[model samples]
Target: MDFNGKCFWITGAASGMGKSLSLLLASFNTQLILSDRDVKGLSQVADKAIALGARVLTLPLDMSDSGSIRKAVSGVLTNVKRIDGLYQFAGISQRSLIIDTPLENDRKIMEVNFFGVIELAKALLPHMIDQGGGQMAVTSSLVGKFGFPYRSAYSASKHALHGYFESLRTENSLNNIRVSILIPGRIQTNISLFALDKDGKEHGKMDPGQANGITAEKAARQILKGLRKEKKEIHVGGKELLMLYIRRFFPALFYYISSRIKPV
Candidate 1:
């Protein structure tokens, strides 16, 4: 669908693919509601969107906090007539083995990555239905479809997204509410640097695979294309895209290969 004159809300708008998407959508003449816990970063992105001649709203949102999400959703409902699109991109990653990872870290990852997206979507579903239809895009990972090393909780959270949104899609088809799960491989972003460790501390270093991955801008463009096509699931990346098929057609081989590959 045409994005011109439409209103889209994006979480994790402070940096990475979300910021890139905001700028790209600005060029398409869309109204953008950008939210993130980083107020200063969000403002910087808003200013850039404003400079690009897009109507922009910046709101503070902490995905781990239900109160913060409720307040942000309230603000959106108060100001915007309808949400044309929702992009759930606020998430943290993990770089530690599940055996060593703390229970709190798993909960934190699930809170931000899975529950946060669900809460916001549930809150907005009624409005979307009232408006006749809307699209929701979620940023999942390659691991969401197939497990990999050092990403047990992260993978589990993303896997939950696939199941939840797929069910939502089936149930909401009559309402015209569409769900698109964007599964990205390794995109060159700072997600790795801020990834949680075994103790919940930051990883503080970028993964080699991520550093060698595609740029966030390219990923955003691909995502937009998939959304426009109304695809149910879109996979974007380099060689990692092959993994999806391998896991599907050759599960035993994929398991052998994946076991040998070091994620970090």
Candidate 2:
């Protein structure tokens, strides 16, 4: 419960759930290293956190670029001696049907949502192991559990996180590194608005489901509590999360309903 002096590094901290979590932790006397490609937005979040009493550092990161990830990791190590946790909240969404999407779009989605995620975790693994132990949590979507319309590539990328991080967790049973995969239904973020289209342009529309979801702050509170308990998979959201159970327990009914839901 008391997080005073603990250090947490979060990506995609410029907006949405990452920014919400950053601000929430600020009141706990925690040290935060926030990263995002939006340098201006990251600065604004950092400034706000400073106002809230957290020791904060801002790093510019581009999830689609390996060089940017490396530079940011180096910066964190240079300034912060320890990371109690590394929360990977950076990802991109897709809004085109598989038939309309190009192969290039799939690659682009993987590069950011999958490669960028594992690269950061791989880079920090040694340090975390050497320092005794640390926790790693990655933000995943509800589609990560099963297929959904207009999210072919996006779902694949999130699905990949489950395989990679689950293996990482089992492999590090002795190393003491804990990995938590966050499966969120919807959290009122701009993910849908910024989703990539078939031609790689932003969809630029607010999804009705996204607009009706819980606030990022509420999602963050659930996440923080789950991470504190070191839960293996933290599910966040409202009744929308029932999909996970339906997919697991009532596969036939799930298919029937999922096929009828309109993708906004």
Candidate 3:
């Protein structure tokens, strides 16, 4: 897609890969509508993008609330003319034994990671279809491709996104709407620290593995390249891409190895 002069709406734009993606798009002279629950951080992103010569709009959004997403998208369309792409990146992760995980925590994770994506897509898809063409990129994870211990809720939510978006892509292909799912392994981000525990509260600590992973900026660049080519799916970070293929081809062996590995 020609990003120049196009407008992209991105959720979770306050920080991490979302922020990096926004910055990368700004470099391409794309207009951006950035949203996050953190109004202060959203403003900072908009300010930086604006200074870099990109037309930026910031909205404080609560992804878990479908109503908020509808209102925000309505407000954006009420002002900005059109959105060329929709990047669904707002999500929450969790690290806890499923048996010990609270039902509320599981609901929260699904709310932000799965339901939020669905609601936003439902709200914005009409605009894209009406315009004749558009792209929808979602940030799933390696966990989305395969299940993992201590991440049951996160895995389920992302997996749901994969299934739903794939169907959506097929259904909308005739309408010129494209969908891209991002499977990212550990990328140096605070996802682990912010991941929820059984009580649905932030874990408040970083996972060493993720801390040593690839930079968010690098991941963003790779993701955009894949999106520009309209790839069905793109995997970022290290050997996780290969692992995903292995799992698809050698499920028994992959499952055995995955079961033995521990994430810190």
Candidate 4:
């Protein structure tokens, strides 16, 4: 896909898929607006993107904070004229069962993973429409496609994204705004390590399944390839992608596998 002279905003740019995508886009002669609560890490990514010949603006803001998002959006509008693409890769995951997980934890995850995402998208929609149109991509999980064990709240948040963005896609079909939902099964990332537990504390462990998954660079390449064709839904993963199809066509087998599969 050609990103030449296009301005793209990436969240969670400090690490994982977001950072990998940022570095890759830098080589594409693109303008970037990178944001993350990790100020130090964000600076590092920005420096590397700059070195790679990308014009980048780093906005250090928390995804869970509305005030911060507002400030960041205003900051973007002030400096940049138009955003060609806005990729939302920032979100918190959960690793607790429903009975053990309280509403507080559920709300917290929803606040960051769902509300924050939609709020930021809503903030940019008007501007994007007024300036013609643009693409918005959201990073959702395989669990987002089907309800998985140990991710009730997390799954709910992603499911909500599908509903919301799918509607946005059709509603704005005439408006020229493209909404792409990125469903990734497992990529080498720190999401599991930082996932919230029953007590709302970090899981603090690198899941073996996640570590064995594709690299963030590979995931980014696949996602970008789908976005290049303006695909509304992009699923990136190995065999894990089969779950989506099985669940769709063979419900009984899918449930059997889901019930026995380890929550890795």
Candidate 5:
């Protein structure tokens, strides 16, 4: 689990939690493949990693497009001997009532958040397996564990990641492949502003709960610790941590209360 000298391929490395993780991993002296659709932002990440004495590669990527993913992965493989770990953090969030949510927007969320992660993992997993071991970490959400109003599509996509990655872990345990699903309740990130609405426009608004959540740096550190321990599931944020326990022991009551909790 030591990152020193290992190659890491991380999506969404431009900012927020992804950027925090990139910085932390660099401090471990890992070779980094930083990817995102923003070339400028990715360049910034690469520069910082280089300054931290880590080998760095910058890749412009569009997670929703499989063709782009294939090309990016191929490019990374050509530049590096192997990927010791892959963190699937590139995703979009949605915040429209299900009945009013545009079907196209919902599909786009699923494409980027679920299918994109799955396809990329499928492509990279063989290399990890061939090496006889590796790690794949996915970012899910608190909504993935339980549905929330105005985020129906997002909830579904994140829930799907949990099921898929958990199964992959079961199937690949003998190969020493570790899968960690991180459920972050509400981190202070651009997620809310970038969340899509029915018209495919940014929500441009904050949910109070999320706005007051943990900082991305703290969340990333906890995530790295969990991945090092090879935990199957990790929930960050105090509110989400409490909810995790409630969901486990009081499913019906939790569902009833959670369903009634409205967005601020």
Candidate 6:
């Protein structure tokens, strides 16, 4: 779809893939409503977008707080007449073993990764329907399709996104609303560095796999291509995509291989 003059709302716009996607979209003349808990980072992104000749609205959004999401949505409606695209990219990852991880950390991951996206989507649905159509692209993971070591809660949250968005796609087909579930393997980003640990503190270190993965810009381009094609689901990554097929068609082998693999 032509993004020229269309308004797109993106969460996690402060950094990583979200920021990369925002810059790419800005080049297409789209108006961006960028939200993130980091006000300074959001300002930086907005400044870059503005410099790129795109209209930008920066809003502080804390995915952990439902009230922050509601306020952000309200602000969006007040300033932007319609949302043409909603990209849910705000999420956290877990790097600790499930047994060692605190229950609170699991809840925290679910809150930011699952419920936060759902709440924001629900809030925007009516507005999207009123506008006669809109597209939503959520950032899931390859782990969403299958279990992985050291990423139990993170994987669970992404798995939930698949179920929820699939239902949403079916229910909103008549409304011209499109939902794209983006399953990214490892993209070069700071997600791993900021991943939550056993006690919910940042991991503070990058995973080797993530460091060796595809660039965020490349991933953003692929995502935009998938969205342009209006695909219901798209997987973008390197060798990790192969694991999906292995998990699906060769479950026992996948299990054996996965068991030997160290995520961190």
Report the lDDT tens digits of candidate 4 across residue range 105-145: 99999999999999999999999999999999998888888
Error of 4 at 98 (Å): 0.8
lDDT of each: 0.92, 0.92, 0.89, 0.92, 0.88, 0.92
User: Where does candidate 2 stray beyond 4 Å?
Assistant: none
Query: Candidate 6 overall Cα lDDT vs. reference?
Result: 0.92
Task: Encode model 6's per-residue lDDT on 221-249: one tens digit a residue.
Answer: 99889988989888887887999899889
Tens-place lDDT digits, model 1, residues 4-120: 889999999999999988888988778999999889999999999989989999989999999999999999999999999998888999999988988999999999999999999
lDDT of 5 by residue, 209-257 (tens): 6689899899889888887887888777766578877888989989888
Candidate 6: lDDT of 24? 90
Off by over 4 Å in 6: none
| Per-residue lDDT over 5-48 for candidate 3, one digit per residue giving the tens place of the 0 to 100 score | 99999998998999989988997788899999989988998998
Segments in model 3 whose C-alpha atoms lie over 4 Å from true places: none
Worst 10 residues of 5 by lDDT: 234-243
Candidates' TM-scores? 0.98, 0.98, 0.97, 0.98, 0.96, 0.98
What is the Cα-based TM-score of model 2?
0.98
